[model samples]
Target: MELKGFSTKCIHGGEEGKYEFDVIPPIHLSSTYQLKYEDQDFVYSRVDNPTRRVLEDKMSVLEKGVASLAFSSGIAAISTVVLSFVKPGEEVILSEDIYGGTKTLFMEILSKRGIKYKYVDTRYADRLEDEISDDTRLVMIESPSNPMMRITDIEKVSKIAHEHGLKVAVDNTFASPYLQNPIELGADITIHSATKYLGGHSDIIAGTATFKTMEDYELVKLHRTRLGGVLSPFDSYLLLRSIKTLEVRMERHCKNAMEIAEYLSNHPKVEDVLYPFLKSFPQYDLARSQMRLGGGMISFKLYTDDQDKVDVFLNSLSIMKKAVSLGGVETLIEQPATMTHRALPDEEKKRLGITPGLIRLSVGIENVEDLISDLENALRNI
Candidate 1:
């Protein structure tokens, strides 16, 4: 039975009802299964696990993909997926506003192995044709990109990439499957750091990669198994439990984020607010076309660039925690220049508008008024 509703899918999508008639899927912790036949579904935990399969199955359905793979971490998923498609000489074209950790992987790790990469503004997807080269193998983007809140047109970019016989992978972490599904928008691959909104409680560290085609799915699964980056059965069970409430959690998250974006936009201390749904956003139309909601991320610049004032504001915050990662039940605030994107060079940070005054907030499913009051109190200090 196919689940038609998003919330229904989250709760019951991958459930097979084969675990001794248990209403909920029980955790299968056996690292090795006793096999009596040559061809068996379960052999080793690294290759596959019942619990992890359920999570992957749910993710595939949620992302509207043919299949999905669970990884030990988000970076591991990115590494496996990229390596599966690209070789040492092949290149990957990336959005300039991607996550800092990704930049490190390409520049520090893959580059040393002869893999080349170039950054471009994917917001204008047609620009890809101008930069496309024979070496280009993959086009990677993050909608409502990390820290900067920039958006890329997935359908337009996917069209251009497909025309060039290239694979398009979208980091769908910021806008969870509830808000957006990259595969539905024509992307070949959709990736997520399930540690975020999928976990909803910041308790687990996991990632997922969903493929539009079974061929890509089988290929990536081979790499993931060889690399031994499979998610543990225990963690998989926890993530599966977390995903059941994803729909309800995201609803509150979006509601709080929209209200917070509006509040910050009107604040005098805030120089500017960057949220996809805001009319003032440079890519508002495109964002609306790609995403169902504004999402829970909001970035704003402070009127003053003084480090002292920034510290004062950060210290004054009572509710929002000053943290690094995002998409949790509790609001988190951070300066990307010093936290998430700090690995990039000074010039790159400057180019991306990650400044001392820039504040990135992952609005959680908290009381809207309380969150706004916390921001107000913090801004007053600044």
Candidate 2:
């Protein structure tokens, strides 16, 4: 039988030994459990759920982490982690290329509590180092950054942060656990918007945080419980099912994205293509050193910045949907200026090179020839 591999484990891991003779985990929807003794493991759903616990355990194994906690939404996980590690007076270092929602959360909520945060171009270690201060508690980053495709050197960044006595957290959402594991590269914690890649389908909205140490786990778990952003048992079950096909789905995504990126790079209408696997990518070497595959996300700049042209191109796309989220079986396309990164200031967007012409694509596990033809048809219509 060859003892089955990761792919098989994705389908049947976590509790195989506990639930004998069962092919799949049964959803435990009970909100409370019988406290036969003191300090019961299952007191309330807010604190934990059986389905979520299994999901967390699987994530721990996937990310090679000591422990994990699941959340209702990606923002919920990020917010809880921030609150757990960062204090009002303390500072946290992050990259300028993070998700817009995360940036907004810091500016609006965390900032109100006096917690200062600095955003640096984390692609370079020197720039990231300059942002660190005596009050810095954490260094947060996203590799192949949101909507821009900027790749950060996690190992180098982690090393620098560790030397400074700062905890390191990487948003491993884009790459997913199949492509990259941040904790293995010295990150204290690896975060994911399981709503995206981990779910593998757009059916569920969930998030996860996997920690390298029990102390961090206990802290994040406490915050997760207190914040009350736990995922529902049903959603947890869906996520678990999705994980089974993640490897296959992600492989197709990577292949499709690479071919699409290459196609766009050569297109007369495209100004630039920003995919880590592309040789022209600035961080191509770094991406190779860390990730197994480039994953599904691709960001490209069009030759024209006119809003009308952008709208026309997006509208003409038949296969790709104009959506906000990523990492699904179906392709998603979006204009950062008016979509995901709209909350960002004009000046900041300009500095980050998130021009009006930029288009972020979440390539799906569709046939490559069909996908490319769809792009070609869309470009012609534009």
Which candidate has the highest TM-score of all? 1
Q: Indicate the TM-score of model 2.
A: 0.97
lDDT of 1 by residue, 24-54 (tens): 7789999999998998999999999999999
Best candidate, lDDT: 1
lDDT of 1 at 357: 94
- Tell me how far candidate 2 lies from the true structure as C-alpha RMSD in angstroms: 1.5
The C-alpha local distance difference test score for the whole of candidate 1 amounts to: 0.92
Question: What RMSD does each model have against the real structure?
Answer: 0.9, 1.5
Please, what are the lDDT tens digits per residue for candidate 2 over residues 1-382? 3325667667756656657676777899999888798987788889988888889888887888999999999899999999999988999888888999999999888999999998998888777667788999999999979988888888889998988999999999999998988999989999999999899789898999999999999999988878789999999989998998888898899999999999999999899999999999988999999899988999999989999989999999888899999999999999999999999999999988888899999999988898889889888876
Clashing pairs in 2: none
